[model samples]
Target: MSLLDEVKNELAAITDDSSLAKQAQVSTMLRFGGGIQLVKNVPVVFAKLTNRSSAAWLKSSIMEIWGYDVELRKASSTLATGETMEYDLVAVTREGKRLALQCGLLDQRSHEITGIAPAHIQGNIAQVKAAWRGAFLAKGRLSDPGKSSMMEIVCPSVDSVNDLIMAARRLGVTAKPHRVNSSVRVRITDPDVIERMLILMGAHTTAREWSGKRVEGETRGKANRLANFDDANMRRSAKAAVEASQKVRHAFEVLGEDIPENLRAAGQLRLDHGDASLEELGRLADPPITKDAIAGRIRRLLQLATKVEKQRAANAEKN
Candidate 1:
């Protein structure tokens, strides 16, 4: 299942007080999907929602909360995959000149609904969690943990988006608001914050699953980085050993028994143990010398090799 579906299913499994759940459901719908519209010159209050199940839940909650049996219907559209997807538009009617006035969608100066405003969002953690859950149910999308950390909720009403930001802060999740063309988005990016939100939304199992995947991905990344570092180090050491062997062979061919014993020992150790690190070569020295001491001997051997090559070139020219 998609991460968004997993979160919604997990939320569906949560059991909470009936009244609080209804309040939260109403709050979410109003902010994200609820609208005041004119139908046949009659005022109609409706929630145009995407998820059919969530729309059904909203319809039921509206009946229980306000004694209204709203009409529910499918608004279908063709997808890019040529699959049909239905949007549930739950609408209710009441006698009023303006639909916004009838649905309490007007500014607070004219209308205010209990349990749906920002003031109602404070002082109760359970109620606040439910409210955010409600808003998320309307328009939430969570990215897969295996890919990235992102959780977002979109609301058509700017006031509702503000309500969401406050409610999230009350739950200790830092949510930022931004405008996306006609809609506003409350986005969260921190993995820790996203996990906390899942837990608050009553998706404990999904949160745990996401955490496990995040940990495993991080562990695998570190292992790959370490392996690459070791491989690069080995290649560099092997290259240095090859160059040291060539210098040592030149020193011996020209100096023979006259070669300094210290230089000769360092060169022979490197030529025999081409894959060994400089530290390991130091340990293999007859006197068990330090890496710096072995390195100086190799330097001297290179210098002697260069002089021997120069002398041979001079002799051949004279001949």
Candidate 2:
């Protein structure tokens, strides 16, 4: 199963305060998942989901908590890729006075906070958290922590997104919303915020797992950066050593025994330890010297070598 499904399954297993769960579940489904339509002149309320676990949870929760039986239907369609996808649709009729009590719960919630406004919901933090949990089970999705830090919910209504933003603010999480195609998407990018939200949604295990992945990914990224830096420094040092050695050879070819003692020492050290850092090369100097001091001598030798090469070019042109 996908990570999202895993989280949903974890949430589905949580059974406490059936009343609160039902309220939150209904509100969430209404905002993010459910639809109202006429089936043979009778108003029908339904929640359609791609994941069987969520649909089963919704079906079982509605029956177990509210004592209302809902009709469960499965429909399938083939994609352009020739893969067939199955959808679960759970529906209840408005016709039966048998479901009147359940329908009343939905209607009452719809009238009071139909727009997804957390502020409009009566009660304390538990209610707010429950609402968020239900909404997530309905429409929430998370990117793998190893890839990116992203958690988002797609809501069919602007009011629902607004409600989500307000609810997150109450939980001390900063959430933003934007339009995606025909829907509004509320997204959270902070790992800490996502973890907190997941816990609020009753998916504590998933939250901990996500946090561990995030830590591992960050540690790997930092190690890669440090290794690249060391490699770049080594390349720079090797290039400098090669150039110094070439200059030293040219000085000897031109000046022969007249080459300066300091330049000769610098050249020999570089040739012997081409991969060594400047500080390490300096330590091997006779009477040991500072890296800056050795570097100065190397610079002078290159300058002299350049002068000799220019003079030879001028002489060749004259000849």
Candidate 3:
């Protein structure tokens, strides 16, 4: 099963606290997921869904809250893998139109109101949670926990998504909206927020499981980054050591046995350990000198080589 389905099923199993909360859920479901449509001069409220649990939950919420028994109709379609089911929970009678009108889904003449959320549930926290839960049931989708950590809800319009964004603020989470044709998608990319949302939507078990998986993934990513850091440091040290050894050899060619004894000893140490760090070179010194002392000696040696190269260049130009 998909992560979304797992969460939706978990949410479906939860019971609402009050009728107001149930109404709030129904309101968001109608506004965002599905809405009122005129069918042969009758206003019918429908929630077209691929998730069975979500469809069941929405239908039951409408029934439980306002005594509207939404009809469940199943449709089949063929795909590359196999046949799939699209569950459409529809309310076609006077009860259906009443439920739609009560939820502010329809205005008397059934012109099909769009992008408006009911005012009754906005102030209450439980109602807000129910509203979000219903919206998710209608159209929310979540990526697998360890893979992407994205959760999104498809909404009816820009104003419809904005209503959810307002609701999200009450839940202490942030959401962004994107438009796809006439519909909008309310998106949450933060893993922490997604887990929090799952908990608020009454999917506590899935929230905890998702949190654990996200933490594990982040830990693994950090470990890999640390290993890469170490590898880069080693490569940088090796390159520096190789360049230092080359410069020290060139200085010897210019100055011959005329070099200072201490500096020559430091240069020889660098030549012997061309892949070693300066601290390691210092440790290998005859008297166990400090890293700074070894680095200063190498710096002076390279300066001497540079001076000789400049002098040779000027001499050749003069010639």
Model number with the top lDDT: 3
Whole-model alpha-carbon lDDT for candidate 3: 0.79
Worst 10 residues of 3 by lDDT: 114-123
Clashing residue pairs in candidate 2 are none
- In terms of TM-score, the best-performing candidate is 2
Candidate 3 deviant stretches above 4 angstroms = 40-42, 63-96, 108-111, 116-120, 143-150, 169-183, 187-193, 309-319
Q: Write down the lDDT of every candidate, Cα atoms only.
A: 0.74, 0.74, 0.79
Each model's TM-score, in the order given? 0.75, 0.85, 0.81
The stretch of ten residues in a row with the least summed lDDT in candidate 1 is 95-104
Candidate 1 residue lDDT tens string, 56-166: 777777776667667889887797799987778777776322434433455446453422455347637777887788778878888776567788987766667777888
Error of 1 at 97 (Å): 9.2
Please report the TM-score between candidate 3 and the true structure. Answer: 0.81
Order the candidates by lDDT, highest first: 3, 2, 1
lDDT (Cα, tens digit) per residue for candidate 2, span 1-319: 7777888888877777457646666657645776565578776667777777778877887777666778779977797799997878877774333342243323433343345533324446776777777778778889887777889988877877887888778777889997776778999988888888898878999889988988898899889999999999889878977876776677767766766888878877877887776788889999899999888887787787778779989999999
- Which tens-of-lDDT digit does each residue in 85-159 have in candidate 3? 556655545666777778778777855666655563465899889888888988888877567788999887777
Q: How well does candidate 1 score on lDDT at residue 271? A: 81
- Once fitted onto the true fold, the runs of candidate 2 whose alpha carbons sit more than 4 angstroms away are 18-20, 76-86, 93-114, 117-120, 315-319
